[model samples]
Target: MAWDLSVDLIKATVQLEQPVGDGSRTVGTGFLISDPTPGGKPRTILVTAAHVFEKMPAMSAKIGYRVQGKDGVWRFDPTTLKIRDGDHPLWVKHPTRDVAAMEVEAPPEFVKAAIPINYLAQDDTFNRYNLGPGDEMMALGFPRGLSANPAGFPILRAGRVASYPLAPATSFPTFLMDFSVFPGNSGGPVFMAEGARRRPGSNQTQEVQFVAGLLTQQVELSGERLEIGIVTHAKFIRETLALLDKLPGATVTQAKAGKTVKGDPPMPPATPAVAISATAMAASR
Candidate 1:
């Protein structure tokens, strides 16, 4: 069967939010990936921008999981996910990038909805697919904490590759996308859904669909929004997932005082509302 990234990935994407003491909630996006363990045990991994989880000071956040009833109606059913044990985070973060990953126990339907691990783009994916500036790509997220509908689905948006030199992922860890990015859009999947594209240096066309990266920040110059998003390469996501195994075990516990412990400092305060270059702002209500 032909793969449909829009539908396939939308099912895997979910909204993450937690209420700050001020009545407003900090919000972000996340998606599920089917990454089985080395022992071949089925596992689901939640992938998102590290700042998304970092900005949520509370130990638990709600994951918007929708349920479909027998009548074919989908209902929003959010569940609490433990993200911290007192002050320490439970998710693994990339050493330098904004990507983060953590193991999650999702409902059976969601497990099936998780995108395959192989769907993440590798270094060769861009060159092989002739992806470059001007190529169109799609992103899924809830901008400004707004969902697509009452069922709590993410909003899909499209944009073009705005920058050049998309390769290696060593020096250029991020690429630019010509899109209007807003808070709550961070951590969403940025992907290519081109059905068929001619391979580089060849007349043959191949169906190219893969996750390119995660939306990390929005670029701004002086105090104006540039409508351009910065996407961290998926390579860092893979690296962060690998770190999950090396790090000491951590678990989520019930919420306590809702105050952060002393030892673990909160993530640096978010960039100013207006940024000089870029703003790493996760959406807040």
Candidate 2:
């Protein structure tokens, strides 16, 4: 069951690529987020790395986004969606957070496969799992543009949690793990075990289920052969969801948001866009 859940989560995330200077390309990852747009929904929002979208020229030929399918397979196409707050690049710099988000026209082949993220609810359960040193985590992504390699599916890599949390570097609670992340894995998911918490009266805490963090950073030691990967706390997931709600005409609302069913809601869809943070600034040398 745990294995299945991990696969399901990967099926929902995507790798984004855009043309950069001199015909080179920048790559990152993002996962699908639920939008409440009405029928003929233009695009789905994908959260990923900020740097991936930054190096693009305004009139680039085309953008590319890739995601896993329901069958645990990789699928991709040229993206027609545009970066939301692309004009405000400084607000979404990599050193401070390293996260970026954009919307894509839902492709006909991918409509039923994507899963909308419940960032708020996931954030509420962050503490349900006591992640700490020595824990093992599974980080899955399409590294080195390997989505179509080997088996044409997302790659899964396992690693151990690092010596300490990464909050100091990212300004948020983060996990340092020993996963090998390549270019295409920048915005993938990093899931860790959240064992059942034991209460004072109870013998042990019951097991709670869900994803733990969004893979964000990695550190390469000069002499060491292996690298350490970092993941941002789940709270930022909630923040991204909130910002999505503030978009001009989004229609998605959570079950607790005065809505019960998981069906689509009425929405006046607008062009897909990436949202930029207001207080965030660019990293200095």
Candidate 3:
């Protein structure tokens, strides 16, 4: 069966938010990936921009999940996800990129919704698919903290590649997309779903679909909105996921009175403990 990225990603993507203590909440986007352990134990990893977790000061954040009723209505069913312990972040980040990944215990339904790890583009995916400047791509995000509806599904948007030299992730870690980026759009996945595209140097066409990257930031100058988003290549995301295995016991360093100290490895906290009060939800708008 052919893969449909647009539909598959919508099921995997989710809204991540945390209360800012004041009236508003910090919002961002994230997607689920099915990356099993070496022993074949089922695992789910949440992938997002590192800055999303960095901006949330609280120890836990709400992951907006939705469920469809038998009556064909979708309802938002958010749950608290612990992102930090004390002052240390639980998610693993790429050494030199904006990508972040963390093991998550999602609902069984969501675990099935996760995209396979093979769907993420590698360093050679671009060349294999003949993807370059001007190629059309789609993105998913909760722009301005608003969902497609009250159900909390992310809004899907499309854009064209705006920059050149889309290869060799080492030399160019990020590329530009011609899209209107917003405050809550960070960490969303950017992907290409071409049913038929000519090969790099051949006349025959082939179906190509894969996640290209993650929207890390928007291009701006002099505080002006440029309608351009910077996307960190998916290669970095693959690398960050590997970090989870390499540093399973990694500790985050903390600064104590001008001195640096290594803290213990982060552990998952209790489930659904941090609830976003109904009053806080109304104030965020």
Candidate with top TM-score is 1
Task: Assess every candidate by TM-score.
Answer: 0.88, 0.64, 0.86
Question: Which model is ahead, 1 or 2, in terms of lDDT?
Answer: 1
Look at candidate 2 and give me any clashing residue pairs. Answer: 36-251, 36-252, 83-274, 84-273, 84-274, 85-274, 197-205, 198-205
Misplaced by over 4 Å in model 3 are 249-285
Question: Backbone collision count in every prediction?
Answer: 1, 8, 0
C-alpha local distance difference test of each model:
0.79, 0.49, 0.78
Better of 1 and 3 by TM-score: 1
Q: Encode model 3's per-residue lDDT on 145-260: one tens digit a residue.
A: 76787777888999999988999999989898889888778899999888888877899988888999998888767667778888899999999988888866644222112111
Query: How are the candidates ranked when ordered by TM-score, highest leading?
Result: 1, 3, 2
Ten-residue region with minimum lDDT total, candidate 2: 276-285
Report the Cα lDDT for residue 64, model 1.
Answer: 78
Give me the displacement of residue 186 in model 1, in angstroms: 0.4
Model 1, 197-240: lDDT tens per residue? 88778888878889999999988677677899999998888888
lDDT, candidate 1, at 94: 90
Q: Considering TM-score, which of the candidate structures 1 and 2 is the better prediction for this target?
A: 1
